[model samples]
Target: MTHDPTDQYLPRGEFSFLSLSIGAMIRVLYYRLRGMRPVRVGHCKQCGACCRNLHLFHRGKWIQTRRQFKRMIAECPEYERFEIMDDPGMLLLFSCRFLSEDNICQDYENRPSACLEYPTLDLHLRSKVLYPNCGYSFKMVKDFGKTMKAVAHIQEQAEDKEDADE
Candidate 1:
């Protein structure tokens, strides 16, 4: 596919609280159906888009750099980058210190908790916090429509239970 340089620094829409809640529901269903699948690794193609465009929230604030990341970690070492919540702890963010002009991680094997959990549907939901420029969110929205529907279904079930109890 042809790369678009403009996409590298574009401001994508913010993820709503509802979207995140639904995404979490979908993630639970995904794990129930499919145990953590071996993530298929792919060469990034060095678009530099991920690094140039990211929305990271660390230590009660949004950040986008190695320095900020270090400081955030220092301030709240217990906080995990959301992306690495799955198996294999790794920070997955749009930008990386090792990222060259070509958009490649200098330290691939020992990257942060976020980098290790790329491409998962849950990760896509949190993309607004990491790589907002990448088209992964759009693709995930399309691919996981059913999962979203299931989330709605689960919500309805919970509401019904509450009403029945009343």
Candidate 2:
């Protein structure tokens, strides 16, 4: 299948508080049903890459136009800390204003949850790629083959119980 570069900037679906919440719940349930999970490893290297290079999402999609960005900022005043660095037509890139020259967050103590929870579990579930030099990485919580076998055994037992009852 041909991959569209702009596809990465598109929202997975229509944006709404309920939709996002339900999407996250579904992702979690999917992994649970598969008897699989992702585990984050490593700690921040303080490279400042995350803060220096950010892709902002607004409403339900990547900020594609300046007007959309302005609307986002107007709705989220705290987003003012991020300054647009480029508009490559399909996407708008931003960088944090509080990142210091020494590769530190000047407002670390008051940083947004997005910053504090960098490399969130959703990133792993969505298979989002991180910076090449990023210190964090994700690994499966259990061996895929083993997990699948266990899930199959549980299903078989449930079927057996139903048959006995019938």
Candidate 3:
């Protein structure tokens, strides 16, 4: 049998330097092609947070607010129900009319692809955007070496400016 190269980096489902390192080019490519994988499975608590603040992909751009989205997709049959609401951040929240009071989706069988990919770590890891009391979580690894180098460069430039001032 041929040796599995990833077996060296990944032992018992654990992964390290899978990305971030040129050494694991194959692993990195594999992950990039497969997209991010969750460490543990997540079950939606039916908080309905995912139902709110819908961002529709219209004309290759994300339209944040519901009113604008409605105007954009007015001709579509599914665009009949929506709510114009205020959210905490710069994004305007739009509640789905199909969602029930207990956070259960009324149209679960016909849910959109965006709904299926809610709370995506890839999308919101840097933004820190997630609903309160979410049961979902994902494991992410940041490149420490690259991050530290950028930090050190910024610090060195700041120090150089300070020394010049003195």
What range of 10 consecutive residues in model 2 has the weakest lDDT sum?
1-10
Candidate 1 lDDT (Cα, 0 to 1): 0.44
The C-alpha local distance difference test score for the whole of candidate 3 amounts to: 0.52
Q: What is each predicted model's overall lDDT from 0 to 1?
A: 0.44, 0.65, 0.52
Better of 1 and 2 by lDDT: 2
Off by over 4 Å in 1: 1-23, 26-43, 57-72, 75-94, 126-166
List CA RMSD, all candidates. 13.7, 10.0, 14.6
| Candidate 1 per-residue lDDT over residues 1-166, each given as its tens digit | 1123243322232233332345555754574464332122223344556444344554434454556766767875533332221222234344344556655555554554333333333445444343434443332222254567778999999999999999
Model 1 poorest 10 in a row by lDDT: 80-89
The 10 consecutive residues of candidate 3 with the worst lDDT sum are 1-10
TM-score of each predicted structure versus truth: 0.35, 0.63, 0.49
Off by over 4 Å in 2: 1-34, 122-127, 143-166
Predicted structure with the largest TM-score when compared to the true one: 2
